[model samples]
Target: YAASKGAAQGLAAGIQAGKGVAIKSLEKLGVKYFWTGMSSEILKMNHYKEVANLTDVIYTAKLKVCDELTYDNFVNMCEQFDIKIGVYTEEVKNALLPKYAVPNALNRIVSEAETTAKEVFEAESTRIAAEITEQQTAVINATYSSWQIAITASVIAIVVIVLIMVIIYLILRYRRKKKMKKKLQYIKLLEE
Candidate 1:
């Protein structure tokens, strides 16, 4: 039994050693392929650079004939050369004035005018609102004054009516007493 156990331990150790060796070999193979791929990419970049240099030389040679071209010929030549026209840098863009300077100036003026008109509209609206408030206050004051006048008139009318009624009652009482005294004197003479 001890011999079999020792053989099993040795087999396990041999398997671990084989695995380490396989892993190291795979690592080395990966590194070799990585460098090979990098070299190929570098060679491709060099070839592209050579091609670009050749194209630049051809383009320079074609530009020599530009000064001899007429209007239609120049347009054809530019088209054939794939020439693009524009400011390609900030310095050139800043140095050259815009072609639409007048239109841009007019646009700015129009924008300012719009802003001023908006401000004026807001001011007019505020003024109109103030006027409306003033008119409302005036209307309320006029209504209150008219109500006061009407109430005063009503109280005066009631007082004048009460005084007239009191005067009429006193006159009626005086006339009734005078008639009763004359009747009493006539009765006494008849009895004698």
Candidate 2:
């Protein structure tokens, strides 16, 4: 259970970090320029709001329960954010930026966001798997050591029992021989 929670937290951290990176990329590509630009009043209000709301969405999503469903939901949110960001970029580019630079810039922003997400997912999942494997290996080694100790103890116990049995047999045989010798001496005395 602890491991599961840890995994969830790790995933959430990765996703949140990825979201921050994506947002930075958007900012670097002049996303905020469109927001505060002089012609911004003419633009569809929802486009900017959607882009702005992304930070809130990501922040809230990260705080949710860390589970598979939560992770899936995050991925879906990222995809949606990607789409919304694309639309916003397109709207801004057509309204403000020159044609020659629009396509590559737009594509780059979206692709960077997607690539960041994929990288985060891969890196975090791999780290988690490695952690689990390391833990499992430790457990296995501990169990193997316990088995070795148990076997060693059993062997020592068996050896001690065998030694005690041998000692008892030797004592019994000596006592029986002594008794026989005494009987013979008595018989010899009777004969005399």
The most accurate candidate by TM-score is 2
Residue 145, candidate 1: C-alpha displacement in angstroms: 4.1
Instruction: Tell me the lDDT of candidate 1.
Output: 0.44
Model 2 Cα displacement at 70 (Å)?
46
**Model 1 superposed RMSD (Cα):** 34.5
Clashes (candidate 1): 0
CA RMSD of all predictions = 34.5, 14.2
TM-score of 1: 0.33
Best by lDDT: 2
Q: Per-residue alpha-carbon lDDT of model 2 for 45-127, expressed as tens digits? A: 22222333344333233223223344576555433433443433433333322232334344455466456656676677667
lDDT of each: 0.44, 0.54
- In model 1, residue pairs whose N, Cα or C atoms come closer than 3 Å (at least 3 residues apart or on different chains), thus clashing, are none
Model 2 bad stretches (over 4 Å): 1-14, 30-106
